[model samples]
Target: MKKILMQLKDYYGEYLLLIALAIVIGLIVGVVDAYFGMILLKITEIRSLSPFLWIPFLPLVGLFIVFMYQKYGKTSSQGMGLIFEVGQGENKVIPFRLIPFIIGGTWLTHLFGGSAGREGVAVQIGATVAHTLGNKLNLMKFQTLLIVIGMAAGFAGLFQTPIAATFFALEVMIAGKFIYPALIPALVASFVASTTSHFLGLEKFQVYLAEPFDFSLFHFLLLAIVGIIFGVVGSLFAKSLSILKSKMAMWFKNPYRRVFIIACGLSVLLLLLYQGRYAGLGTNLITASFSGQHIYSYDFILKLIFTVCTLAVGFQGGEVTPLFSIGATLGVVLANILHLPVTLFAALGYAAVFGSATNTLLAPILIGCEVFGFEHFPSFFIVCAFAYFFNFNQSIYGKQQILK
Candidate 1:
């Protein structure tokens, strides 16, 4: 007991320093996420106002985006891939330029009406900031822990869901592994960042959901069916994204021509189909799902296709927001079909689809509880569990590994 206490005493200073650094990370990342989220939302609103005017320029914007990356920020284009590499101990640095490149690229993609999401950009931004700080301070020995803390800060700042962000950062780097040591620092950073961003005017999307289903065997069975369906859709989304990215790369050969050509066709199709209904972050669909607005049976599938295609052609954005939108929209349809509460099922899909697509069960459950009410925690767990196991371990992030 004396020896253990001495050892703890010796290391306490280092641990305290790390905790202090986490506070700094949280504040910095929170500010960045707030600006990023606010601007992205503004961009989405701008595109919504005059879809035709902005969307027709998608091909030109795509060309510009490709040119910028190739010219000044080639390594930065790796985005989440670099974050994964650093976490996996395969690489040590994330280019500082990644911050500007991803944010700029995503803004342009949204401004010109591309179907995509913003969470990826936020995560990358957070990772880059933390990694840079760690490297400069010679904290490379704690690289994975720092990265996890940064991820949590970034995600929590944008979504204002600290617990979900903490677990997501902890578990997302490896399929079966959680960075236990990072838990304390990450949790602190997540809460701080979330509060900071909320203070900075980045709003969190939340809805109160009072569940109707008690934990009966019949309800469990019914939720299982819903979970299974969401899992299948999530897996399909991940698989389709991977295939499309590879196939498009092979077919185009030149990234410039690839993005431009695809963007041209995408521009026309986006214009033709509901006049850019499926464009941007799919937040519109998410809103429609929660509100009593009209959601067609096909809203989910169309959003899925558009989001997949947009990313496949090298558009800069995250898959997560669109995934949430896809899941929520699908949940509404599924609820109607299954004779369940539309809002409740929509909430379920909102969480489960994200869980399955990202292949992180804990994050989804926590996010569901955070965004909705904690009273639905049990339901979130059951649905997310079903979705996670049923997804076949597919992930939108190609670099994510299933630990053996």
Candidate 2:
């Protein structure tokens, strides 16, 4: 035991510097995320009259995105692929040039009413920071680990889910195998980042639920059914996005050109459908879930469609946030049909669907515990596990190869 303790101590110190660096990187990422969100909200106000007014010219926004990418962002096109490359021992550092491209591109995409999420942009920024720092400092393998930890910190800071964020950084690449060694550093960075962001007045997503209801056999059975449905939906969303992206890529030799045309076309369609409700980050859908308001039974379906189109067309953003909105809405509708509490179902749906889509079991379970409290752990674990299995190893990141 003493030998084991001593070895652990040595290993812990090895990562101490990396953890500290991740915390600092996380702080910057948090600020950027918050500022970006504020800017998007302001833009939404400017275009608030109606989506209809913007529909006719919406494709122009996509053209502008393409123009910017062609002019300045050719190298950063890989996004998450770049991160995975770096993780797997590639020397390709995300150049500082990408920071501006992502920031500008993402801002433009959202300002013009593209349906997307912000976390992916933030993660790339965070990883870029870590990459730059590692290169400048001449750090070795351990520094690469720090970069991954920085990713978790950025995610935790943005979403305010420290535990989930820690696991997410480790879980995102593949299924089954947990990166146990990185857990401590990831957790430390995530918690510090989340705390710092909270101190800076970043609000976490809040959901109101009544006391733990009795979990009868019937409730478990219903929850399992919800898990299966969510799994199917999640799988479909991922597959659709992959297929669309591939087809678009095949049709256009240049990715940038393809993205521009597709984005513009989708924007126009969105404008025609123009409820002014499904645009931007779709946070309103999340709010509606908590409030027990009636949502379009097909709200999840529409969001899935729009999000896939937006992302497939090269709008940089994370898929998780939109997944949350879609899952919560789906849950609410499902709950109503099953005569269950909307709040409960919505919460379960949110985590389980995400878990299934990402092929992450424990991350979503921890997310549920962190966001909705530990009392829901049993249901969360069961539902998320079922969802994970039902999804059959599908994921939004199609390149990810699951070892376990």
Candidate 3:
């Protein structure tokens, strides 16, 4: 008892310090996240109002964005790769320019009818702020912990799912190995950031499952099938993006020319495909999936294709929101085929596809419970388990380490 008491006394100050740091980080990052998110949404709305007018200029806009990177971005264009390197002890520094470059570039992309997501910018913003602050404070020993805290806060602020964000930051960088040492600080940061963003008027997406179904063996089999489909789709998305990115680089040696040419092609195809139906963040498809509106079976596939093209050709944004849209749309089709509840499976797909794409497990399950109701836990668990197991270890983050 005396030894335990002494140990607690010795570590109490450290714990208190970390906790305080987490609150500060969360508050600041959450505010920035709200600002970024709200602006991005505004850009999306502006683009939607006149997609044809802006989408035709995607090639020019892409060239300008590439030129900006070539001139001023330097190594900052590596974006998330640098964050992973620092987290993995590579002793790299993320350029402060990354914050503005990504935000501006993403805004341009969206404003010009690019199909992308915003969480990447939010995460980068949080990391940049937290990392800069930690360095200024000379908190060298806990840099990795601080970065994880920032990541958690960033995700929580945007999605308002603190538990899921905590798990995501803990498990995302290194698959199969949660960052146990930073769990407490990360959790604190996540909750604080979530609350701050909510108070700042950033809304979270949620759905309710009004119907209940018995979890019989037949239902289990059907869910497993759905999981397998989601897993395959997620894997395909990651793989296609990776391959296309590389191919685009190889095909066009210059960044400016590459973006210009590809964006031109994308502009034509995007307009031809239902007058930019696959443009922007894909929230329209997600909304349609849940609102009993028209959802063609091909919606998911087109979204996957367009999103892959958008990012491969130097468009800015995260793949997460698009993944959510794809999963939800696919879920609608699967539910129709399986004769299950549409909303329940749509919710499951929203989480499971994200899990499979990121090669994660717990984060998606928690997101399902958080975004959908906790009553859907059983179905979510069954589907996510199979999805994770069948993903074959593909991940959207190429730098993510697979821990065996």
Candidate 4:
């Protein structure tokens, strides 16, 4: 007891300060994320009402987006890469402009019917705010740790999934490696941010799965197979986006021309395909998947393609939400084929596909439980374990390093 008491006494000061800092970060980030997310949602609604009004101008908007980057973006154009570099100690600072640039760029992307997501922007916003504050406070040695706290706050604030956000911030920077040192601060930040955002009226997407089924050995095997499929789907998404980005860059050899021409082509296909069904964040597909509406078997593939092309051609947005939509829709198809409960598997896919793509394991499992119901955690755990193992180490964050 003396030894334990002495150790606690020795570390209490530092721990207490960290906890306080985390709370402050969470509160500030939560408000910022709430405002950003709510505006984006409103933009999505307006676009949904008349996709044709804005989608036709995608090419023009693409040119303007490209111009912004060319004129003043500098290292900011690196996007998530900048965050990874900072986390890895390869970079010391994240430019503050990254927050507004990404938020505005993503808003423009969705408004113009581009297929993309918002989490990436939210994360960048959180990291930039946290890192900047840390720098100002002269906590130079603790840069990476502070960034992790901010990242957790950002994700939790946006999704209202604190546990999942905590694990994601800890594990995402290095595949298969968790930063135990930052766990406490990350947890505190995530929970505080989640609560703040919820109170600020940022709605969370959740599906309470009520179907009951025994976890028989046969059921385990079936879920394992589904996990593998989701893993491969995630693998394909990361690989395709990376390859397409390179090919488009090579083919155009000019940023302005690339975004303009590709955006034109994308605009046509998006409008033609079910009258912009694959537009925005793929939320339509997500809604359809769980609402007992028609989810075409080809829906997932089209969303994946459109998202890849949209991002590859320089459209600004994140990939995570679309990935969730893809997984949910694909899960519906798999459930039909495998004769399983559609909603349950849809919930599973919503988490698993994201796990596979991000090369994250625990976050997806916890997210599944949090968003669905903890009662189904056994199923999510088994499926996510297999999905993580089978993801082939693919990640959407190219700058993320592999731990040796």
Clash tally, candidates in order: 0, 1, 0, 0
lDDT of 1 by residue, 326-345 (tens): 99999999988888899988
lDDT of candidate 4 at residue 161, scale 0 to 100: 94
Clashing residue pairs found in predicted model 4: none
For model 2 the local lDDT of residue 212 reads 69
Every model's TM-score: 0.98, 0.91, 0.97, 0.97
* Residue-wise C-alpha lDDT for candidate 4, range 319-344, written one tens digit per residue: 99999999999999999999999999
Tens-digit lDDT string for candidate 3 (12-113): 877778889999999998998888888888888888888888899999999888889889999888878788888787855778898889989999998888
Whole-model lDDT per candidate:
0.93, 0.77, 0.88, 0.91
By lDDT, is 1 or 2 better? 1
Query: Model 1 has how many clashing residue pairs?
Result: 0
In candidate 3, position 387 carries an lDDT of: 91
Lowest summed lDDT window (length 10), candidate 1: 9-18
Ten-residue segment with the worst summed lDDT in candidate 3? 85-94
Candidate 4 stretches with Cα past 4 Å from truth are 1-10
Which stretches of candidate 2 lie above 4 Å from their native place? Answer: 1-12, 45-56, 254-257
* lDDT winner between candidates 1 and 4: 1
Top-TM-score structure, candidate number: 1
> Where is the poorest 10-residue window by lDDT in model 2?
49-58
